[model samples]
Target: MTTTSPLRSEDRGNASVTRLSPFQPLTDEQQRLVDSIVRFCERHSHDGHAALVMEGDAGTGKSLVLNTAFQRIQSEARDRDSTRSLHGMRNILLVNHPEMIKLYRNIAATIPTLRKKDYERPTSFINAMHKSEQRVDIVFIDEAHLLLTRTDPYNHFRQSNQLEEILKLARIVVLVFDPRQTLKFKGYWDDAHLRTLLAGIPTETISLTEQFRVEANPDVMTWIRALCDGHLLPLPAKQHFDFRIYDDAARMYDDICQRNDACGQSRILATYDFPYTLNGEDHFVQTGSFHLRWDRNQPTHPLPWAERPESIDEVGSVYTVQGFDLNYAGVILGPSMSYDKVTDRVVFHPDRYEDRAAFSGGGRITDTPRAQCQVMANALFVILTRARQGLYIKAVDPALNERLMLLWKERG
Candidate 1:
């Protein structure tokens, strides 16, 4: 159960933030996508406001493809003897997640050509572009769903839409988007919205369907996806993967610690049902004898929350582990999620959900109750997919716990 993923990047232990190196070995499909991206960039380097939308589910190697293509495009830009298609281009990479920003910046440190400054948050990149009145050749945005769609003065993002602003500044904008990963109301996005944004603008969409993170088989993946979509199906048997349900959260934490000791990058994750704040105080997530605190916001911290060894005692939320890979993940489905016997489906309780920021739309998102429920479901989907080798779950709701245990027993 402590087995780490065999495909984990060799450099992960060193950086503790990255799942793959920029030049890490790529599968044939990944390489082809990277090549196509480079060609797209080259062809549209001088074109006006063109976009390449790369859409995929969680763990589809979207970030890897973006990084590899970026490196190649930067190489082409620097090569004097080449066609100079991207020569002297000013390209930047944007990600709204702080943990992802840390990962990419760490990855940039090892490469002489890739500057850490080139990797930035979308808000920062957009603000800098406006202040300088500068236009870039290509802009690569990872986790584009996290981009703010409406003006948020708190984040200093005054734009109505992030992608629209980036398109205005860059000739070719490449974005990696997953609608399922959109967690906050401020950054809400979907295919229709994306199409509307790119209405008159030239664009191409590429979808990646392969599952690259989990070691589980197709049946296991289907079960997980179904559960995330609010349907609780019969739990499937594991194949080449470890999946289990724990009645005692304390026991689950013990196993996660053991996995972390045996292999690195193992941690416990939970839904945002518990109350927490950034007022420099401790908030513990208690379940029976299991006691842990939520991952703190450490803006100056170098390593990601899950990467820090001390984080084993802390519970991570979707924000911390979304783009990172874990050797093993012990997930706590909080009280906000429950199993309804009448419907035989997983139900979300917006009143019980504690992530207030995710619900505060400031008039950007309508249907407040449904939007809050979707936020909870989206958080579950993200935490459920973080595990590479194994997934262990401990449900807080009594009815849900009972139902999950019954389903686990059926996994014969």
Candidate 2:
């Protein structure tokens, strides 16, 4: 639907959303930022080659802010239009956004797509928009952190397939991303040239600092900061965060079941880095056990069980659990195996280290975890914030926890 309209809300009086948020209202700061950016968009009024890079910590209302702004833009456009022509002018083309797997994948070179969900077709939805004369006034990239440079080692497809052309089109491109979530791949912000190229266009940056995720747990924030910066916080353990590092995940799972079962809701996230034949795509990664339940007295975990659903019962990874939350969350960090900090680079956690010697024959593929710690820390911070009431973290690797503690110690 190419309709320009503001997000309708019944509770404008509410300051910040808190109670089991399905729809989170923007914070005052976020709203102000959106107003300024939207004002700029209204003022500049360009038809081609313009963009806004929206980056922030997760839970800081990046998506909410953009959605609110887009709605406001629609309202403003409508207010100005006596002929309802501005609605057509305000046509927005959201490019290559990440969301529910089915809806996104179905939007292909041909719509109403058919195939197994494991399709590898559209990367940057921008290129498709650019080719169409459909008049997209603004282009918003939801997970812009997933944006890859023309030089990343994807190895499967052509580089010129996406991003560039769309950047060349559109009145304004709003990029909402957090590079911390980019543990598995390289994104648009990773490369300097791409940044420079995007910067070459008229751009302004708006950063969100107030975090709405991970409530009442400052330690989670501290650990995140320490991980991101080598202990660059006032106090890493400012408050108490219950996310613990357990030696045994199964035991933790049992404990979680027992405790949460009493309240009749227990969810488990079995982060098993295992080799499985689920349609035969090797998921080669380390896994662990994570459990979160409403109460702590349940006898056992439930089914539909492994993956999270909007029903608020079972739990899974970012894939299923995203857009939903719980009273208490326990994210089991399998291993601090994704990064290192000693050599000032992004290296895979030694535990999850895949031998790339046969391919690169060197350390080019694996960077020093230290180098990537800043990004990783940011990511961990975002993940930690996902909890509303309490957070329980259980890292399998003691050394990783120690490193985290060290980061806290250094923060002093």
Candidate 3:
């Protein structure tokens, strides 16, 4: 199951520090933000404090930042309460934001002590917390981007929502999120909703804007930032990227793979839409770009594979790789990001693009006009930055991939 995911040892009990170095030391702004966040946690480590938001661009080191800060927070919390059901808040469960309350429910279901249908909505959530007495010092949301807004049809229950329930239960809550990586309004994302959830507390929020992923100068990085920021007009309002286009994905991949064998590890990618569309055949994952594959298609599998599997490790969606990282990542922009010049606009098959979306129009935007650009930017952010030194992009559409070709051509 090593598919698109990073190597996960069966017992992930052993913490793995990021081997990658910082692109640049945290900017004064980032340091100030981290200082404030760290101090807030220090004060609240004993338990009970206002909520905090860890805001940043995707792959800007927010995870690393939060993780490092959390270690200190846990250490401080333990100093205060030795018997708090956690050696260092071991009772605390860091859940993804989108599936916030639902995640709590799912974990509760597994425990025999907790009742599955005990209650619904926030009431259910609070009741469960009360039953478990998860009165720890803090509650953390790891992938806060998944946290949805109220407009989502999939999420009907308000009180049971992740944000709402966390407010109700935890003495202190720390949520790390990048609106850039946010999915959709499964919940509500309006200012009104934000105020209601985080309204009162003086939010010690900061945006991590520096990119440690792509090794580029300010000029080139600016273009990448513009694309992701949705400042690039007519591009679905997302942080776009600069890349090298390839008419032949397979040939380019073969060359990269060969080069990788010569130097070090390298990867090949393709969208589910044309999984193996590289040489012109559906040889990769049966699923296209949208469908995330963790370890092949098999659900139950080993964690850190003794030996890397065959094609399973070769192709996967961006989602599967989220959390996990690698030495080098190569991306093939499938037909998904293809903009038909004839149509004069990009056309994305809803089923292909990644689910994450940036906030743009005042309403819910599907995977077509808005979803593709934002998700692709995020994917690019992750893929490019994962490699310590290099990033390779092979976009199929001659038109779309050409934007990337400029970087290479200019280099020459």
| Each candidate: RMSD | 3.6, 10.6, 8.9
The digit string of per-residue lDDT tens for model 3 on 235-312 reads: 211223323434445555555454444444444554434433223333443222223332243223322111133322
Q: lDDT tens string, model 1, 268-367? A: 8889989998899989888887877788889789977867777776789898988888889999999999999999988999888888888776485657
List the candidates' TM-scores in order: 0.95, 0.64, 0.64
Off by over 4 Å in 3: 1-16, 19-35, 44-49, 80-93, 97-134, 148-160, 184-196, 226-244, 258-265, 271-312, 340-385, 401-411
- Which one wins by lDDT: 2 or 3? 3
Q: Positional deviation of 145 in candidate 1, in angstroms?
A: 0.4
Worst window of 10 by summed lDDT in candidate 3: 14-23
Whole-model lDDT per candidate? 0.84, 0.46, 0.48
Model 2, 1-412: lDDT tens digits are 1111122222212122222121345678987888876776765575466677777776666656765565556555656444443344443535232332323233222222122232222353443544575445766565555445444335332454245655655667776656665443333245454476677677777888886656655556665555445342333354543454445545555554443444322344423222223342323323333223221212132312212222233334443334333445555565543334575332334334222111221133355444344444444444455555455555555665555455444655
- In model 1, which range of ten residues has the least summed lDDT? 2-11
The residue pairs found clashing in candidate 1 are none
